[model samples]
Target: MSKSQATPNSAATGAESPDAILFREGMSRAAAAVHVVTTDGEAGRAGFTATAVTPVTDSPASLLVCVNTASRSAQALLANRAFCVNTLGAEDLALADIFAGRTGLQGQDRFTVGAWEKLETGSPALTTSLVSFDCRISDARVVATHHVIIGEIVGIRLGERKPPLIYQGRHYHKL
Candidate 1:
């Protein structure tokens, strides 16, 4: 998610540069675990499908999640100052689409499809997730069009170890 930006070469051409296009195409081939990051607080409830979550350290039990600034859930996630990264299993493909905005279900409505519960941070943790990292936002930085949030893990909920849901070649796969 913290990919280095392509230098500003499109100003004259008014089109995406070749390097940026190729980078995206190459990245698409790289498989990543799917996750539904959910949050709830004064900003209400919000969730989104993300492949940008990763661990930063374990001493303080921290992880990083990247969210697009333009996403509808961005404001709530930032304002809430907490979130849960629910690592999906193979069975959760439809749930991923629901949270990813493909179903047109906005805000709290997306929670209707899943069995969710709050952990230490009061963020919604999917009961069926392979694992749910409930965290408090420790730090945040804006890089390009995304918010790179570092979260301190305050709790973890482990579910059955099942085949993981992955995204690659712009499609969902199970492994």
Candidate 2:
């Protein structure tokens, strides 16, 4: 997890700035899908939990993933050049917690949280995920406090009538 940094602002007087408070407040209200990102590299197999995953565009079949530089898994993803985003289900709370850094499991240890398999692109897709996207990263940009990764989807393992796990107000919700 990336630690929140104090942004220097001329308008702000105290420790917390208006921009920081508003950003957190906005994120707190916005519900997001829970996903586990996995990658295999020459260094080793690595995976991490991410809630900042979103579909960017379909014209090029692409999506955006925001990864914190503080995470070792981010480096692994950069080295591997491929990754899979496993969209969680309502029953995947245990798996989500494990990957979300709430269970104290790091790196490959988190893989033991659930049954995993590989897609055609060789990225690890959870066997029980609601949906899985196998992608090769096309570009990466470090913006703000995260690395915004752009990936081109080449394969998809879609589920049937599966609802996604959601996170809102710092808590998990089932859709």
Candidate 3:
């Protein structure tokens, strides 16, 4: 049985406390698409590399993105109430590292490394991303150390099909 299945009664019996480290380790095995979530508005322009964006619904064309509450971009994203999810291609590995803060650049400085353009929401959309979703924040809730943002898609930009950049096992993968 899987670890999650084995722990079915853990929450009820309090017999097996959830281990954060173990949970993260298990999650690391799962592959996730890499994206750069960006925003530009009165709050200022900000962007960050992320892997926690997912579709939440289709009726209203919505997506959910988890942003670290302490991240520098969080304040701007919240204040602006708009964002763009730029799905990266395999060639964007270096761009990902820059936006992820591996290069020590912050705020608008991150944009200097990539070509960008504004979409419907005025958020910075990556010019060569595999795909870009411009959205308006429909709602947001803080959970633990992250802010769960619900975005209503307003525009979408599609680029040439290419191998996507994926994150798994604490590393990048191309597929």
Q: Which candidate wins on TM-score?
A: 3
* lDDT scores of the candidates, listed in order: 0.93, 0.84, 0.93
Better of 2 and 3 by TM-score: 3
Q: Estimate each model's TM-score.
A: 0.89, 0.86, 0.94
Candidate 1 lDDT over residue span 1-175, tens digit each: 3346554567787977658577788789999999999999999999999999999999999999999999989889999999999999999999999999998888888999989999988999999999999999999989998999999999999999899999999999999
Task: Tell me the tens digit of each residue's lDDT in model 2 across 1-175.
Answer: 2345445565665555547676787688889889988888675788877888989999899889999987888888988898999888988888988877888887778887678888876778998898899999999988877899999998999866677889999899988
Instruction: Write down the worst ten-residue block by lDDT for model 1.
Output: 1-10
Clashes per candidate, residues 3 or more apart or on different chains: 0, 0, 0
Residue 55 lDDT in model 2? Answer: 92
Clashes of 3: 0
| Tens digits of per-residue lDDT for model 3, 22-115 | 7788799999999999999999999989999999999899999999998989999999999999999999999999999999887777888879
Tell me, what's the RMSD of every candidate? 5.0, 5.4, 1.9
Q: What is the descending lDDT order? A: 1, 3, 2
Clashing residue pairs in candidate 1 (N, C-alpha, C atoms within 3 angstroms): none
Error of 1 at 77 (Å): 0.7
Ranked candidates (TM-score, high to low): 3, 1, 2
* Local distance difference test, candidate 2: 0.84
